[model samples]
Target: MALRMNVQARLDHRFAATYNRFMAAAERRWAYESRGQLLSGLTGRVLEVGAGTGVNIPHYKNADHVVLVEPWPAMRSQLHQKVARDARVATTVVDAVVEDLPFPGASFDAVVCTFVLCSVEDSYAALAEIQRVLRPGGTLAFLEHVRGGWLASRVQDLLTPVIRRFAAGCHPNRDTEGDIERAGFTVLQSETLKPLPVVPWFAPFVKGAASPADHP
Candidate 1:
C-alpha cells in the first residue's frame, strides 16, 4: 500500500507537470473564452479551488484579490510561476484541496472552480466547503466537463479506472451538474457545450454560475 501510494503520487506529479501543455489546444479552442465568461465581473475577495496551473489567472480582470488553491506540489509549483509573472490581480497560492479548504466560514465573496469537481475525492464534501467559505449571496463560478450521453457515459465509466490512474484522479463519468444542485446551489445560468470535439467522452461541458440556495 505504501508503494502504491508513492507510485500514485509520482503519477500525479507527472500529470501536473504536463497538464498545461495537455490542455493548451483545448484552452485556445474554447476554454479561455468560457473562463472569461464565467469569471468576468468578479469582485471582492475571491477564492479559486483546485486552480491547476493558474489557467484562469488572466481572466480575473475585475477581482480585487485572488486566492488560488492547488493540492499537488507540482501543480502548485507551476501555479506559483504563473502567479509570479501575472500582475493583473493580486494573488496568493495555497497548498490545499477543495474538500478541505483551510479558511473561516463566509470569508470570500466569490469562489471559482474550473475542471475540478470531477476529480475531487468527495464532490459533495468539496461543494459543502465551497458553500461554507462563501459569503452570503456569494457566487460560485464554474466550468467543468461532466457525464455525457448514455453511450458516452458508458464509455466514460469503462475508461474511468484507467483514466483516473493516468489523468490525476479525474473521473469522466461524474454527474457534476446534478451534484451541484443536490449540494444546494441554485443554478443561476448554465450552458452545456462540446468544447473538445476530438475528445468525445469529454463532451458536454457545463459552464455556469450558482449561489447557495439558502442565501438566495
Candidate 2:
C-alpha cells in the first residue's frame, strides 16, 4: 500500500510538472490577453488555488497580497522560484489543496481559480471552502474549461478515463459554471471563449466572477 501510494504521488508530481512546462507555451499562445483581463479587478488579500508555475503572478496588480494554495510539491517548487523572483507584490505560497483550506471564515477579500476545478477531487467542497474563506460580498473569479458542444462533449467523455490516468486527473468534461452557481454563489458575470483550434477536449472555456448569496 505504501509503495503504491508513493508511486502514485511521484507520478502525480511528475505529471503536474510536465503539464506546466507543456502548457506554458500554449498559455502564451491562447490565453495571454485573457489572463490579465480575468484578474483585472481584484483587491485586498486574495487566495489563488492551483497557482501552477505562478503564471498569473505577473498579472496581479490590484491585490494587496496573494496567498497561493498549490498541493503538488513539484508545482509548489516552481511557484516558490517565481515568487522569489517576483518583486512587484507580496505573495505567500502554501502547500495546500482547495477542498480544505486552512484559513478562518471571511478571511479573504477575493478568491481566484483558473483551470483548476476540473482536477479537484471534490469541486463542490472546494467551492464551499472558497465561499467560507471569503468575506461577505467578496469575489470569486475563475477561468475554466467546461463541456463543449455535443461532439466535443462526447470526445471529452471518451478521453477522460485515459486523460485522468496521465493528465493530473483533469476531467475534460465538467459543467463547472453550473457547479459554481449551484454552490450558492450569485453569478455576477460570465463569458465563454474558444480554446486553440486543435485541442477540442480543452475547448469551450468560461471566465467569470461570482459572489456568495449570503454570509453567516
Candidate 3:
C-alpha cells in the first residue's frame, strides 16, 4: 500500500506539472470554450469532481453553493488559490477522490464533471459514488473528450499506457457517454462534438446533462 501510494503521488506530481504548463494555453484556445457553457448552467448545491486547478471556478456564476473534490495535493493547492481569489459563490474544497467521496448520501443537488472521468481509478465506482451523493432529481453535467474515430482511436489506445505514466492515469479512449448511461442516469441532452482540427488524436468530445433515472 505504501509503494502504491508513493507511485500515485509521483503521477499526481507529474500531472500537476504538466497541467500547470499547458492549462493556460488550452483554456485560451479550446478548453474554455468547450467547458464554460456547461459550467455556467450549474446551480444549487453543486459538487465538482477533479476540480483541477479550479478551471471551472470563473464559470460557476449560477451556483449558490459549490464544493470541489480534488485528491491530488498539487491540484488542490492551485484550487485553493483560485477559490480564494473568487468569492462569487460560497465554496469549499475537499481533498478527496470521486470513488470515495466524503459527503453524505443525497447531499448535493448537482454535480459537475469535466475533463475528469478519463483519469479516475475506477470510472464505474466514481460514477456510482456520484449517483449515491446526488439528491433524487439532481443534475449531472459533464464535458469530456472521448474515443475518437477508427484511426485516432487506435492511436489513443496505443498511447494510453505511456500517457498514464505522467498524465495521472488519463485514458484518452474511454467510452464515457456509454458509462454515464449504464450508471442508471437518464441522459437529458447529449452532443458529440467535432474533433479539434489541430489534435485529431484527442478529438471527439461529449457534453450533456443527465439526471438519476430512478428519481422519485
Candidate 4:
C-alpha cells in the first residue's frame, strides 16, 4: 500500500489532467443522481477535500466560510481558474494533502468530498484528517467510487495492477465504505448507484458522512 501510495503521489499531474477532463462527464452523471444532494450535503464552515477543479463550488450553499483542499498542483491551478470564474467562491483554497490538513481541530461544521477519493493512496489516513479538522458531530459528505462485490472485485484485481502503472494508481476495486468504517467513522446513509463507462461499477458515488454520535 505504501508503495502504491508513492506511485500515486508521483503520477499526480499526469492523472490530474486526465481526471479533470473526465470530471465534467462524471459530474453530469452525478448531477442526475445527486442534484441537490450535494447542496443538501453542505452547511456551515465547510472543507471540501481533494476539491479537484472545484466542480462542487456551485453546489454549495451560502456559508460563513468554505475551504477547498487539493494537493495536485496541476489540478490546483485548474481549481484556481474555476474559482476565478465563479462568484460564490469567495472562500479560501489550499493546495495541500488531506493527510496533513492546515487547520486546527474541530474547526468546521461540515467536510465535503466529491469524486476525489478514488486515487487517494491512504484513504483511511485522509479520513482521519477529515475527522480531526471537523468539529465534533460535523458532517463529512462525500461522493466516491469504490470496489464493488465479488465479480467486480475479481476483475478490478486483474486490471488494477495494469491500470496503476498507466492510470495514475487509480483503483477500481477499493472497498471505500469499508475503509471509511475502518477509519473510525459511522456510515449514516449510503447506496449503490449507476455504473460508469469503460470502468464497470464506477459512477454516481454513494453519499455518506462519518461523525461520532454525541461526538466528543
> 1-216, model 1: which lDDT tens digit per residue?
999999999899888888888988888888888898888789999999999889899888888999999988888888898998874889999998888889999999999989999889799999999999999999999899999899899999999999999999898999998999999999899999875364866768999999999987
**By summed lDDT, which 10 consecutive residues of candidate 1 come out lowest?**
194-203
Residue pairs that clash (backbone atoms under 3 angstroms), model 2: none
> Candidate 1 or 2, higher TM-score?
1
For all predicted structures, in order, the TM-scores are 0.96, 0.93, 0.91, 0.84
TM-score (C-alpha, index-matched) for candidate 3? 0.91
Worst 10 residues of 3 by lDDT: 194-203
* Per-candidate local distance difference test: 0.90, 0.86, 0.86, 0.72
- List, residue by residue over 150-177, the lDDT tens digit for candidate 4: 7777887778777766665566677777
Q: What is the lDDT of residue 165 in candidate 4?
A: 64
lDDT (10s digit) by residue, model 3, range 136-213: 999999998898888888999999888777788888888898899898999999988874454655668888999988
lDDT of 2: 0.86
User: Which of 1 and 3 is the better model by lDDT?
Assistant: 1
Off by over 4 Å in 3: 1-8
Candidate 2 Cα misplacement greater than 4 A, ranges: 1-7
Query: Comparing 1 and 4 by lDDT, which wins?
Result: 1
lDDT of model 3 at position 36 = 77
Worst 10 residues of 2 by lDDT: 24-33
* Cα error of candidate 4 at position 213, Å: 5.1
Q: Candidate 2 has what TM-score?
A: 0.93
Clash number for model 3? 0
Residue 102, candidate 3: C-alpha displacement in angstroms: 1.2
